[model samples]
Target chain A: MPVVGMVGGGQLARMTAAAAVGLGATFRVLAESANESAALVTHDVAIGSHLSLPDIAAFAAECDVITFDHEHVPGAILAELESAGVLVRPGSAALGYTQNKLAMRERLSSLGVPCPRFAPVVSVADVEKFAAGSWPVVLKAVRGGYDGKGVWVCDSAVEAAEVISHGIPLLAEEFVPFRRELAALVAMSPSGQGAAYPVVQTIQVDGICREVIAPAPGLDPDLAIEAEAMALGIAAQLGVTGLLAVELFETRAGGLLANELAMRPHNSGHWTIEGAVTSQFEQHLRAVLDLPLGSCVPAGTFTVMANLLGGTDPDVFDRYIHVMAADPTVKVHFYGKEVRQGRKIGHVTIVGGPGDSVESLRDRARRAASYLRWGTEDGE
Target chain B: MPVVGMVGGGQLARMTAAAAVGLGATFRVLAESANESAALVTHDVAIGSHLSLPDIAAFAAECDVITFDHEHVPGAILAELESAGVLVRPGSAALGYTQNKLAMRERLSSLGVPCPRFAPVVSVADVEKFAAGSWPVVLKAVRGGYDGKGVWVCDSAVEAAEVISHGIPLLAEEFVPFRRELAALVAMSPSGQGAAYPVVQTIQVDGICREVIAPAPGLDPDLAIEAEAMALGIAAQLGVTGLLAVELFETRAGGLLANELAMRPHNSGHWTIEGAVTSQFEQHLRAVLDLPLGSCVPAGTFTVMANLLGGTDPDVFDRYIHVMAADPTVKVHFYGKEVRQGRKIGHVTIVGGPGDSVESLRDRARRAASYLRWGTEDGE
Candidate 1:
């Protein structure tokens, strides 16, 4: 069995571990803690921080192909590894653009990919001018942001100034009114056999994805096709291996713009586990290991995945009973995480349609997830 | 948080670890080896063997409930624990009848539950008398039977006599020319609440289950209702805690006969992991711990579960690509067991239809499991 080394140890790495088992592949995990990564499920666990060069060198030496749980590894080290003959999927040069939001915008723009008008903001003055053109401007941290963190929306100069801190370069962008948030997930094989799942609508709450609806309800077939094509084109152009999640904005103005790029598995593709024939996790293993890519097609007309956020209450087991008994169709997946406020504790994926409609499925998924967090019988 | 002590260590325990995490239940695994049971996932490995009563007592001392990863534990030891004031779910008395086929038959006869007529034959002469009443007899070893082992079908008096002498005292039954095989999966709580998944048709080949079609496709509605009722009655009467799989033979004579019983998580119920709202693992945890039982309604009218037999091929990974790419709708699960011929390695579940008709589901399910094994494009 080929050994696949992963950079970060999170749920994505955990899922990859599940996929690797099916393929009879080995996973070499580099987690900060013993229980942080899916390492417990697999063969080898390397306990260390991602920043340590010797730790990474030891991890790299034991694996056949190297991949990422998240794209946070320093580019210099990756480049050094590459020069020293280590195989890195989505090699360092392409990964650099994704690691830094500023570099991402510049590269995508140069490649003629559609994106929102944006400007770098090191100070309040930069935000003041951007917000003046549009009623609301989006302020984003240049690096390290997830789940609505380090992001702000400014209706005017005052709001944007609140987030502008000393010495940190931020970016301000036109806050385009969007019809829905969509994601086009593609697995680009080492040989470049690109496979794309149907465009899915991702519901965001406080900037963190709360739910994902596959086939993006009410989406035009042509628009979805275009989005998928764009995702494939971007992955192939970048010569990327493994999964690439192209997060998009389906603007009310009638065009899909690239919102962001994720080099590893993303929350929006969770529905694929139940709704697609081949899960993104399985396809990622196939791609990074340079094996034949599995099919990426929707199995159901509609699939809904709701994120389980650890809410205010500490003991949610009481609520899980209510959620499970409420519906027989929704599938719940809870991570082995100690519950904390607003943390992604788990998720529920529901697939229906052609037989069961989108509304019923969505309601069931929403009710199941909400019940887990808040024990609401009447809410949905 | 109550602690549940488990015997043995394997994938079933690994999945149970995932469920116990959500419920905040602690599992103290008494495994034969390190990192063998689901307790390994939670790092709750108790390094000891079920054979060692001293070590077993120490494990039992920590847990509030005693359960099992398998049904191989000595019945005498179990009775001793119950005598010593340990709370063992489905105590030795209940499990003894299940562990021994002869005892099970005698108990079922006394209880007047409908079952196949059988005689406990200790020698070839006793088998001759049994064969005279039933020309085709199914012979089974009294203990430790799994995945088509310890079973034989004798069509001739010569074969019957030879078969009986070969094994220890065994149960020989009149073979039922059944229309279809079915399973009544019921979760029996400590409080005696019984939850039943729709009776599902069991697809078999050479005495091994290949697929399970929910609602036992094409059976009369009354028959489906009766199966659930019979399962509930047995669960309640036996005071069986946790889940009980009542495998039944739907005969050509138009009645269901009890075939076998499993007190813990059984292979027949694996479909619930993806096809039902709550998995059997979750339900088992809830029931054994005396929590409220969840609804047992089918997720769809048709949820088919197919078992994957370990094959002799070295290129096993290719089979994954063929099945996953061919049918994204089919749910596949592998146990991460080292492969060998004719082994119950894993299973695939495919759910279909308009949420009605058991036969339709059975057909779909049969095709999913068979396709994986045979690598065919045509579904059952």
Candidate 2:
């Protein structure tokens, strides 16, 4: 029975807490506020900032190992804790790549991993040089970017310059025309064991993930194996101890390129809660505890997950009963966060059996999610 | 979302709390102690006795609807709460039959349900008369008994007198020469909607449930349907809301007979956690909340659930890592309770897909459970 301390209390921590209950593990989370998603449902929560070294250190003291819900803790703080002999999974050196896009790109590129051509942009001149090869370049913050925030697709140098004017550390990458977004979610143990879930296709709306389809329908078998291998390789190379979600771009040319890296459980793997034999949350705990990883086999032929983003209605539960009645098979997950427009309040997932149409599953998931958000069968 | 308050915070409440996290509902538990299984992991817990009327009242005040983890709550207490306008699912009237075996047998027999011939035993003469047609008879306490407690198989009038002399309100039943024990688990909403899970055969050791096999292998399809219909009819007839697990006796002649009833989540339905599309815990919550009951379809063709009773080892986690590695597909659920010999510490379940043998699944589940209880796979 190990005590796993998770930093940054959010939905990931909330779901992980639920998963930990089955494993007979004591899970503790450090939240910035008592009202955070994880704090609302879990018993052991320390109200503190991830940014404060003292808060993290105090929180880490009681746990056998410390993991993260989000990789937002300053690297210096993580490094300090490690130096003081605290067992931090996905330690500072590996976390640096996820915390900084520029570092991730450089490391992946050096490791011969397929990744977008990118460069650090300290000034507008750098952005201009990077975008010279392509008119519409993707500009990403070097740090503190999530859920489509701090990211800008610049059509021209003028747009890139305007974004850089905010004085945030930025990076410029050549925007590739991709067929669709894919995610390779893998977990690694300190014992060097790694397990990869089936690669899944993630649908993005305005850069925020809206839906996810497991096993990436009609994905080339060879390509799927390659993606899984690449993720496991990246996890091993980066010394990642827990879950690593490698977001990829499935290029139109039938090639794959790494897009982003998440050192903790990512939104893309949320479908695994019902789709895979071992959910990412549970896998993360096994990895962090240095225990053997569970099976990553798919439980169904196809599974679709739809994010329940808050809409005009701040009451997410207003149509919950209707949604449950409409689709009894759809599994709903709420984060216990107050609903605000465009915020990810919860998600819905539907696991399809053999001969079950993926479109039908996706439609059911979406319909339920929409009804919860808009109180209508459709999102009208 | 509605708040669900469950009295008696054992493993059942602990598991229901885990399921509650996904439904966006607030779950609070009334536990006899702060360290009860459910109280340890759940955020909202009232460390109070279910027997205390004031404690139950206070706990029920915060909940939209109240349910039970166990049937130990007094009928008078529940009646008092109901009279005061507190919403209690599986109201006292329905729970009465479950609490008192004699009442259950009498009601089921009157409802035309097949049951063992029985008579209330007020004295040794009463037991002698009931056992006049048979040498061996079954004796059960009318109330406050669980597992093997308050139950006995009496041989001859001498043994019957010993049991009846205890004078704790007893009932005499003709010994059922059954092939195996089966349980029909079903859930009913307050709106009268009902859902029945596949009939499962339960294996008991020393009158304690040891393992459960979903769908009762080799069972006649018609009989399965009949069992389900009978359970549903009983649920409606008794006005039982939430979950009703009807323990049944399948005679050597293929006839089914009612054995016992549990108005709350029962051990026989624990396999539903991983074996069914909607777990019993989640279904109980939905039914008590008056929401539409989720589908009761089996997630896999066959599932084997093996209870992990504490053995010589008080340290249950000693071999947990080994068990996880041995059977990655086996799902483990542990109650946050200290291990004591013969106490139920946890359970391990394995779901079988098409072409998977029930024997193999049962063996795997048993091996994992034994390993968790003892340090060795064979419980050596």
Candidate 3:
């Protein structure tokens, strides 16, 4: 059996481990602690930090291919593994683009990909200069930021300078006044075969993904095709060997501007678990293994996925029985984590048939997710 | 986390472990060896035989509820566990019917469920007498027989006498010349709620289930409804708390006769893994855990599942890439076992769309299974 080593032990890795079992592939996870979601279920877990070179080397020694559950692993460590012939997928070069916002902007812009105009900033002066063309610019940390962290919207140079006192490497970009956010996910094998999932409308609140609807209901056929083509183009250009999520701004003017990039399984694709011909997690495993990719066609007419953020309820398991009994069609996924306010503990997916309304699917998923989080059917 | 301890470590337990992860439930398996299929993937494995009383006790103590992967766990041991207050789903009384074919036949007959005429025999003379009425009788060992083992079809008293010399507890039954074999799978909860899956046609090769087609193509609608009703009635009567697979023979006269019973996940329902809204393995977990059972509605227009029996090839992983590439929609499941001649190593399932032909679906599943078993697309 070929061993696939994952560098993180989050819910993404937990799901990947489940998919690995079906593939008859041995899965190993390097966890910072035994309590991480994936570590709790995976059989082979190495308790180590991603920052430790020796830990990375030890974990890589046992795997036929090394991949990641998150892109937080330093680029130097991944580069080291690659030099040692460890077969790190979505290799360090591709990860470098996702790891740093400025690098991704530069690369995509240079490739003539549609993207928000951006420039690396040393001080507020640079931000002011960039804002000369577009006011109310968005300033984001170059690296090590996620879920609303390390990002700020500044209307003027003084406001941007005050926020920059945190001393983080910053990049300024044109604030996209988009009608909605969409994500196009694609999986590519090392052998150059790629498969694209339908473009999905992603709802984000406080920079945390709240829900996703597949195929972006009523999306223009031409724009959907263009988004998929753009995502595929980026994956090819980056030589990304697993799932690549291109978060885009669907501007009111009917054009797409690249917003962000994620090179692993993304929250926007969670609906694929039950709604698509092949799940993104399964496709990622196949891609990293250089195996033939599975079909990415939608299995149902519509799919709605809602994240279950941790609320006051400490025991989500108690609510499972109720949620399941309420809607037998809703698929529930729980990430084994201690309940902390606003943390993502799990998600619910509801797939609708051709005759079913998307509004009903979305309501059912949201209701199920709310019940799980609050232990009430009214979905407060 | 509530721990579910399973008493056997076959593919049934392996699939259940995967489902348990989705439920955020802790799954523990008591395996006879470390090399059992479920033992390889499951994290909490007790390497002890189910036959050992102390081992069963130790395993049961760690679990909130107990179940079985196979019906081979001795009834007395289960009774002892029950006496000790360990919760065992489908309790010892229910498993008793499945463990002893004569017991199942007797119970079904007394309950007025249709079944073949059967009699327990102690000697060759008794077998000879039973065969006198039927001409050709099927003799089966009363216990510990599976996959065509311990079964013999004797045409005459002389042949019956020769086969009975094997010295196993035997039962003789009238051989029903049937049109085909069918299975009705139902999931029941301790609360008396029951859900039935679609009746399926099962193809048996040498008593081993080789293929199964859901909703039994060309099956009479009335007969299908009757089969489901019978299965649900049997589950409620037997007090079976998990999955009950009631294998039946559709007589040449269009009547249905009970053929066999399995008190756990059965091979015939494997198609539900991808073909139905809820998989049998997931439903089993829900039923055993006393949670609400999921929907049993089929997810596709049709589904065909084919077992991948081990052939001359020892390396199944090598053929997986080809099988997956050949048919991306075929869901492959490997038992993670070394290949041996005629052993069931894995299975493949294919779901058809609204416009797809069942024949094409069956052909695709068979070709995938054959390629996995023999590395040939022509299924030779």
Candidate 4:
């Protein structure tokens, strides 16, 4: 029996626990507390802080391999675990690059990967020189950033100077107007076998993910093929064992430039749960376990996923029935979380076949969220 | 916020927990321990014996409504709970009929429902009377029987005497040479509304379900309609509040006889999880909660399901990758159980459109089980 240990106990860990049920795998979770999320389903739950190495070592001893739900594990501890021979998916060496974008951009550029032109900028002088020829520049912190945080856009150099004093490692690059956003997800086994899911377009609102449309909805065959190729190339080059989600910017010149990367599961690939024959969660587990990959075709011709955000009330979870009663075909997954404003509580996924209208799918997804979060249809 | 309390913690409870997630209902389990059988995903589990009414009440106090995974709840306690206003679904009156075969037969016969002619046989003379014209007769215990247990076939009065002496409240009935076994399931609400799922052919080996063919391949249109009508009639007449599974014995003479009734979700309806527009589990939750019923139309062109039995070795649970790697579309569900011989450990369901061969479907289901249980590709 293989006992798998996970570092975090959030929704990602909750979903992975659900997938682990099929293989009869035992999942041990190191939650921050006894009542933390995902503690309901895991076989063994150890309440401990992430920075406690003894606690992590105790949790890891009960499992054959260790993985992570978030990228907050320090590189020093990861290296210590690796030296002590605990199998870690996405080892510290490969994850270090993505943890800090400055290292990733410089490394990928040297390796001949197509990345946006950028230079390290710690002061106003550095930012002005980088944007001298370019009219607009985007400034980003190399670490501790997610969901559009730690980012600033300057139409001129003066705007960059005000944000430079934050003292985080900064990278300034020329801002290019892109046609659309695309994400390519790749899973590679420890033994070098790999599989790629179809590229999808991500829709964001107020710096939060809202939906994902497979094949970017209207992507040509050539572009789709190119996306898969680029994604697989990065996974193989980085020796990424589990999953790699690379965000791309479709330049006006018809080429894709690397925008960002997530070394673990990302919001862009959530559609794979219902759309693909093999879900990304299953694929990631198989890859890390050194097992064979499954098929990677969409379960239906078209699929759309909408995230469920937490509502204002503390009892927002009571609205789940109203949504499920209206549309039984919609698949809803809820994370057992305390509700507050703007927190991701769950998601609804609906798959439609070829020629299915996007508006109808979108309506169903939104209605499901509305019904589950706020009881908008309660009186009716 | 409906907190539903379930008496038995098993696979059925596990599935009910899955459905409760979608409906935003909470589930509390009364089992021997937190890991008795269904501690994987329940809301809160009370560790105590079900026979202890105080323990049961303590569990029920946290629930607004009470239900059961199996028909093993004591009638007296249920009556007590009913008197206390706990809202026991299917109520004690309805459940008592299904709890005892003798009572079920008598009620069905009085209601003009089609059933095999039977007679209570306390002595060999009674068996001789019933077997005078019939060469063979079926003898069954009145209660506490399932999965080929407590049933026997007698070709002579002497044989019948030996079997009937095994228990009190036994009966003898004329045996029917049935062409096949079929099941019709219906979900009825407290408001008198009911929905019927498609009739499915049940393949039994040694009285255990092996595979189920949804819509009962090659069934006549009239017969199919009649099956649905009969199921609805039975459910409405019985005032069933959740699922009612009617097991039918189809005689060679083209007639149907009632074999048994299950007042909750049955194995035959497992195919609906992935094959129908709405799964039976979700429908059951809706009906019991008095929510609107969903359409019972088949989602794909066909659906097939097979049960997976656990073997002796406990380590056999780690074969998740082999089965998934073989066919990712084959949905396998496992009940977190310690392996036991001949025990129903889990099941696999397959859904596809027309042109999928029955042999292939059967092979896929069996192969998944074989892979999970023995780590062998014998079925493949």
Candidate 5:
């Protein structure tokens, strides 16, 4: 059996390990701690940091291919692994675009892909120059930011200057006033076959994804197709051999612009676990291993996913019985993590049939998530 | 978190471990060997024999609730665990019925449940007397029979006399010329809440389950309800706390008769993995932990599951890429076992939408399984 080594031992890796079991493949996770989600489930786990070259090399030595649960690995380490002949899906070259915001913007721009105007910032002057054409710009750290961290929206150059003082390499982009954010997820194999999941409307709060609705609810079919095509195009152009999530902004002016790129299973595709014929985690495994991708057809007419953010109560098991009894059809997934307010602990997914509406499914999922998070049935 | 200790570490235990992860619960397995299916995946594994009382007692001490993957454990051992105040789902009293065929027949018959006429047999004379009423009788060991093992079909006293010389405890059952074998699966929590999966038609080969069709094609709606009611009745009467599989015979007379009983997850319910909202594995976890049972609603119009029996090819991973590419909608489940002739290595499940016929779904699933088993696309 071919061994797949995942760089991060988070929930994504944990789910992927479960998927790999079905394929009878060896799945190894490199974890910083023994208690990490994936490390707890998988038998072949190497306790190591993703940043340590020796640790990564040792883990890679046992693996036929190296993939990732998160895109936090340093590009240099991935490049080094590539040079040493270790197969890394979404190779260092493609991962470079996801590792640094400026690199992604430059590459996408060069490909004539729909993207917001962006500029690398050495100082506030760089932001000011970009702001001359579009005000209220978004400032982001070039690397190492997740779940709303290292991102700032500034209305003035003064705010941009204050952010620049943080000393992190920065990039400024024209902040599109979007009606809603959408994510297009696609999986590609080294053989060049691609599978696209339905475009989903991602609900973000404080720049963190809170919920997602497959097929984008009432979005035009043509737009969904266009978004899927764009994501497929990005995966093909980047030579990405795994799941590619293109987060797009649905501009108020009736156009879509790519906001970010994630080269692994993304949170926006979580609903696919129960709602689609094939899950993103399984597809990722198949793609990285250069196997054929599974069908991306939705199993239900409407599917909704709501993140189970940690709340006041820490004991989630106590609430599980109540949540399960309340909504018999809802699927609840919990990441083995201690509860802390606002942390992504787990999620709930619900699928509605053809006769059911998206709003009803969303409400059911949110209610289930609320019950799991805070033990409330009313979803407060 | 409640730690569930499963006595046998087979595929049932392996899948339950995966389900326990979703519930944020800890799962432990006691396997006779380190290479057992569940032992390979679960983090907490105790290498011990199920027959060892000391080993089971030590394993039970670490578990909040103890369950079983197989019913091979002795009744005295389970009774001992109960006496020790260790929580055991489907307590020893109920498990006794599944462990001994004569006991099951007596109990169900006393309950006025529909069951095939059966009697204990000490010699060929007893079998001859039973055969006097029913010509063709099915002879089975009172204990320790599985997958066609320890079973015989006696057409006359001469045949029964030859089998009696083996000196194993025996029982003779009236052989029903049935239309097909069907299974009704139910999960019940300690609180008495119960959920039932759709009745399924099980195709058996040499007494081993080969394929299962959910919703039992051509089954009368009233008969399906009756079978579910009977299964639920058995669960309640027997005090089965986790999964209860009631194997039935649809007789030529158009009524159902209970054929066998399983206290744990059974091969017949494997279709629920992709066909039902809550899989049997997950439902078992929820029920054993005294949590609310999840819904057993079907996910699609129909579903077919076919077992992947090991064949000439031992390299399953080598064929996975081809199998997945050939049928994108088929969900394959591998048991992580070395292939051997006639051994159940894995299974494949495929769901059909409203527009698809059950015949088509079964064909697709069978083709996928054949390809997986023989490494031939044409299923030759």
Candidate 6:
């Protein structure tokens, strides 16, 4: 058995700890506080900051391999750990690109991977030049941006100047009009064994992922195969040892363009916990431990996962029983976090059976999540 | 979220803790040592003995409801807790029947449940009279027996006398020519809600369960329904609030006979972790907490579970990688315990998909378990 140390203690780490128990692996999480989600469940936890090199080095000393729950650790810290002979899955070289969006776009573009046209932004002049072809342009912080944060859609140079005055490193990109968002999740081991889950269509509300449908309903089989290949190829090209989730934009032209790269388990793959033969959490562990990857075959016809964002209700457990009673087949997962308005509290998954339609499964999942969040079938 | 306290820290509690995390429930286990299976994984563990009244009382103080990982707690201690107004699922009165074999048999017989002919054995004459119509009768200890221990087969009066000479409480039963052993697992909530899993055929060697095949291949559908109904009826009649595992002997006469009773999560239901829509561990948590029970539908066509008992190899993990690589679809669950010859260390499960035969699935599961246990596919 291997001791897997994760760098962050969010829900991803919490779910990964559950998977580690089944695999007979000793899991340790380096969390920021004792009350963090993973810290509450796993026995072996080190309370520390991921940004502190000394804190991470001390935690990594007791583990066979170190991974991440979120891509927030500075690349320099991971590089230092690697220099100290610590086994860091998805090593510093690979994580560098994910930490900086400008670097990721440059690397993918150089590798001939389809992506949005982009340029580094030092001033409003750079943004104006980049937006020459389009009126509205997407300005993204070069680092530390997640869930719609640190991003602004500028309609003109005046708006761009306002965002640029914040004095944060930024990048400019073409605002591609896309039909929907799709995510291709792939896991690769150090031994070069790779496995890819089905591409899923993700629905985002205000830039936060709200729902996901596996196999991206009505997707061309050829396109799904191509997407999987592209993700696996990216993992191999980037020398990634764990999970790499490539969020893509399905353009109206029926082409796929990579939108973002997440070097750990992403929200779009949460449905795989019940929909796929092997969960992403378990696969990530196997990858980091250099063990054989489990099969990524879908377990059912369709699986719909709905994110349970906190609504007006702070105490959602009162509504939990109601949702459980209303649907016996829907699976609920909760992160041990205090609920706040619009915060991601948990998720609901519904796997479609033999005669079940994708629409029906989505509706069931949505209803359960909505009830748990707002105490209503429909989010009012 | 509610705090769930399990009295014993075995593999059952370890798996239950995994489920508890998914439901956002706080789980605590009382273990004799820090290295117990459940204690190793769960953070909130109390180093105490179930036999110690004071220790149990302290553990119960932190829990909203108390449950058992095994039926080894003394009835008197649980009774004391109940008198103190502590909430104990499968209250002492119901657990008493599971603790004493003679009492369980008598109560089932009185309830018109089909069972083997049996009587208390105060002397050799009782065994002789009970075996008048048969030879090689089964002698069982009335309490504290598991996995072939505290059980004996008496060929004549002399052997019966030798077992009785030990002076432990004993019971005599007629030898049954059973076709095969089947287990019906049912869960009931304090609210009187009941859910039954598919009947599974259990293969045993020397009274130790080795493998379980869900739905009892080739079993009559009507008989499966009858077995489920009978088990549910028994749970209600006995006032069992958590889980009741009814072990049955399908006699050569095509009738089911009650064999044994377990009021906690039993080995026979381990397959439900991956086979059923709702795992037995999760169901037990929901039942004891009086939350709505999840559906018990099979997740696939068929599922086979093979126990991984330690063989001559003291380090079974040396062979684990081989098993994981050989079959990616087979799910392995290890109970973090030291490997001792013939001791249950883990289990392997394979869920059959379309075009898969029950035999093929069984072979895959058995091969994985055997390889991990003995470093050979055939257990040579």
Candidate 2 chain B has its poorest 10 consecutive residues by lDDT at B371-380
Error of 5 at A251 (Å): 1.4
Clash count list over all predictions: 8, 0, 0, 1, 0, 0
TM-score of chain B of each: 0.90, 0.98, 0.97, 0.95, 0.98, 0.98
Error of 4 at A371 (Å): 4.7
Q: State the lDDT of candidate 6 residue by residue for A156-250, as single tens digits.
A: 99999999999999999999899999999999999999999999999988889999999799998888988999999999999999999999999
* lDDT (tens digit, per residue) of candidate 5 on A162-201: 9999999999888888999999999999999999999999
Report the backbone clash tally of model 5: 0
lDDT of 1 by residue, B1-380 (tens): 46887777776666665555434456666778764534334445777887777777788898899887778878988888888888888778878877898888888878888998898888767777877765778889999887668888888777877776675768888888998889999988877777888788877888787777665657899998888888888888777888888999998888999999888888788877656656787788878888777656555557777777765663456666666555545656656565677776677776654653555555555565555555553533
Models, CA RMSD each:
4.0, 1.2, 1.3, 3.1, 1.3, 1.1
Clashing pairs in 2: none
The prediction achieving the highest lDDT against the true structure is 6
For residues A84-133, what per-residue lDDT tens digits would candidate 2 score against the true structure? 99999989999999888888888999999998888888887898887775
Cα deviation at B117, candidate 5, in Å, is: 1.0
**Which pairs of residues have clashing backbones in candidate 6?**
none
Candidate 2: stretches off by over 4 Å = none
**lDDT tens readout by residue for model 6, B71-179:** 9999999999999999999899999998899999999999999998888988988898888857889999999999889889899999999999999999998888999
Estimate TM-scores for all models: 0.87, 0.98, 0.98, 0.92, 0.98, 0.99
Residue A305's lDDT within candidate 2 is: 95
lDDT of 3 at A64: 94
Clashes of 6: 0
Q: What is the docking quality class of candidate 2?
A: high
Off by over 4 Å in 6: none
Which pairs of residues collide in model 1? A277-B328, B13-B38, B14-B38, B217-B358, B217-B359, B218-B359, B301-B355, B367-B380
For residues A1-380, could you state the per-residue lDDT of candidate 4 as single tens digits? Answer: 46778888877776776566554456677889766666654556888877777878778888788887778787888888888889988888888877788998987788777888999998999998988867789998888788878778887767887789777789987787888778899888888988888888877776678787776777877888887888788888887888888898878888888888777777787777667766776677777777677667776766788888877776764466556557756877767677877788778888776557877877788788776667673321
